[model samples]
Target: MKILITGGAGFVGSALAIALKQNYPHYQVLALDNLKRRGSELNLSRLKAAGVEFTHGDIRSKEDFDALPAVDAVIEASAEPSVLAGLDGTPDYLINTNLFGTVNCLNYALKHKANFIFLSTSRVYPIKTIETLNFVEEATRFALSDEQPVPGVSAKGIAENFPLDGARSLYGTTKLASELLIQEYNEFYGLRTVINRCGVLTGPWQMGKVDQGVMVLWIAKHYFQQQLGYFGYGGTGKQIRDMLHVADLYRLIDWQLHHLDQVNGEILNVGGGLESSASLQELTQVCQEVTGHTIPIKAVAETRTADIRLYVTDNTKVTNLTGWKPEIGIRRIVEDITAWLAENEKDLAPILK
Candidate 1:
């Protein structure tokens, strides 16, 4: 089996490629990315060393799409991922990358008769109610629906069944639009497709920016001793998020692709679930434990727009179907990231944008 993964040089894409190569050697993995972002080259090198084929291209280019090798599956990982940055750029770029880019990839995959899996985000849900969920403040974080558990949803976090309609920012609007496109495509083309609305995804090679990958940013700040700001620190710096190891995420994708016939047009929430949720203060402690550094951080007066104060996915659907679970915990994630950074410190400085 051959697979084409867009944004293969990225943190999650590259890790997915490596995981695929290790687990399924018979499967040829081809990764395509524009390599426009910092640390992507290093990510590409990591994948190349793992024996995966690397291709340089943009997902928006028709020539690039036409150039890809025939494959049984296409994992659409490419995106302008920042929910915050979408506000600055023209709606055209947002439409092109988040909306049309996905349309183009789905078209390509359908033309080739390939299964598709999109790396969607939890931001597609409304943030107003999320921030307003009933919660009791803990020493470090907040707890939700404390009175009654809502089966798969309340116990786990945000379930796939959550309404997509509340007030959404520009980023969520674009993703929500694209997700509808994929759902429609699956119905029209009989193409097997699943939208995995992932939570915070972080691993060793992640190039975290101010707008995305907050967990890695936390670790990166400690690793570099860089100046850091805490947005919701007054709330105990306890904004919780379910962060998953990209390797485990690849396993879930592999399971879905192999069992596409069993499920079609399913919008699944993918993440570490409640088990992977962590607060900023907890993460800072992890950083302190990992780096042995009592890092100093400044607190920002306000939180960003569309910020989910405490939202985690209820990944019961995925676990029930695939029997896939995250093997690495948060502590392990911090340790692994610290170790990887320590070994690759010299190379890391160049990639810090």
Candidate 2:
């Protein structure tokens, strides 16, 4: 099978390409990326070393997709991925790349009769709704309130059916809009499209910036003794997020590819869930324990735009359907990222600057 991964040189995209090659040696994997992200260019060698073909191209341009040969499947993983995008400037680039880029990808898939997989964000859920989720604070993190029983949510966390009613930020708006377009494409053209709303996907090879890859950013900051700050929400740093390692996503994608027929047109909340969640404080403790250092962190009393309180993936649906659950916990996430950063500290010197 010939497969194309958009944003192929990115952390998630490159990891998927490498993992796919290892698991399915007979399949040819091609990755196309603009290398616009600060650390994206670093993945070119990694992808090439893994026997994955690389193309320096942007998904925002239809000509890039036109250059590719017909493939059996397309993994649409390209995006800006910053929730704060467009708040300080125009969101045109985010919309053009994420929403319109999917349109271009769908056109490419239609031409090739290839199946489509959209790597969407959990941010598609409304920000107001999430911010309103009833929670009580503990020593280091927050948990759901027993007084309120949110539909599609429990101690396990938010599910696919979580309410979607308010502004989800410019980044999320683009992804949700793209999802609608994908559904339309599937219905009108009978295109086999599957959507995975993933939350906090991270691991090695991630050139994490402040706006994206927060988990990786946290670890890198701690390991390198970089100054850290907790902004907004009184700077309590109690805001919670669940993390899922990229390797676990590889396992799920493999199963989905083999059983596309069964999972077609399905939207699953794919993530590490409550079992793998942690707060900034909890994360700091772990980093201190793992790296054995007191990483200084400041409390900035202003919250950033579009920042939410807590988000945990409820993987029950995907777990029941495909028997897939995250195997990498927060500790392993710290270990792998720490090891990768230490080894690639020289190569990543420019971005880490």
Candidate 3:
């Protein structure tokens, strides 16, 4: 199979490429990215060294899409994934890169008659509905219901059925728009399209940025000697998040490729579920335990725009459909992130600036 992955030089995209090459050796993987992010070049360089084909191109440019090699599948991983960056009269980049970029990708997919997979985010859910959640504070984290059921088993976490139109932030709006675009393309072109509304994805080869990979940044700072900052503490330092390893997503996409007819035009919330969740305080403690450091913690004045209070995904739909769930835990997440940092410390130096 010939596969083309956009944003393949970024964290999730690069790791997906590595996972595909390792697991499906007969398949040919072509990664396309602008390499605009700091250290994205490093990602592409590493992939090239590993024998993956690549093209230096921006999704915003039509010529880039036209130039793409024919492929059996197209993974639309490209996006300006900074929620906060979109708030400061700068959402155009998000729309251009995410919305318009997706249009280009879908068009390319239809033109080539290839299957499409889009990498969406949980942030597509509006912040108002999440804020209205009546979560209670626990010793280590926040519980959705007063009953405090086990992790990965709460209805309060955003499910695929949640109302999506609750005062979306700029970032959320674009993602939501792109999601619509994927569906529309599927209807209009008969394209086999799958939408995975992914939550926090972290693993090796990620140049974790503040806007996109918050969890990875926290892990990198705590264990890898990078500087760290906490925006809010009064949320009890337990603002919970469901994080999944990128490898798990590789499995999902692999499954989708095989069941193209079954998975097409379906939207699924993909994540670590309730079982693989953590808060700022809990993450800090884990970092301390693993790194034997204080893991400095501080507080800021207010929450960033559209910061969800306790964002976890039900992930039951994907589980039911593909029998896929997170195989890695938070502990393994930290260990692998630390290992990635140690292995690529020299290459990551540019982004550390």
Best by TM-score: 2
What lDDT tens digits, residue by residue, belong to model 3 across residues 77-115? Answer: 888877785677767777899888888888888999999
Model 2 per-residue lDDT tens digits across residues 1-353: 99999999999999999999988888999999998888888888888888999998998999988788889999998999888888778988988999999999999999999999999999999887887778988988888764554576666788998888889998998999999999999999999999999999999988777888988889888888889998877888898999999999999988888889988999999999998999998999899888777877999988777888888999999999899999999998999988888888888766763
TM-score of 3: 0.94
Error of 1 at 2 (Å): 1.3
Task: Give the TM-scores of the predictions, in the order they appear.
Answer: 0.94, 0.97, 0.94
Model 3, C-alpha of 97: deviation from truth (Å) = 0.6
Model 2, runs deviating above 4 Å: none
CA lDDT, candidate 2, residue 270: 95
Instruction: Please give the lDDT score for candidate 1.
Output: 0.81
lDDT of each: 0.81, 0.89, 0.80
Clash pairs of candidate 1?
A: none
lDDT of 1 by residue, 83-129 (tens): 77567657776677788888889989998999998999888888775
Model 1: residues >4 Å from true position, as ranges? 147-155, 233-235
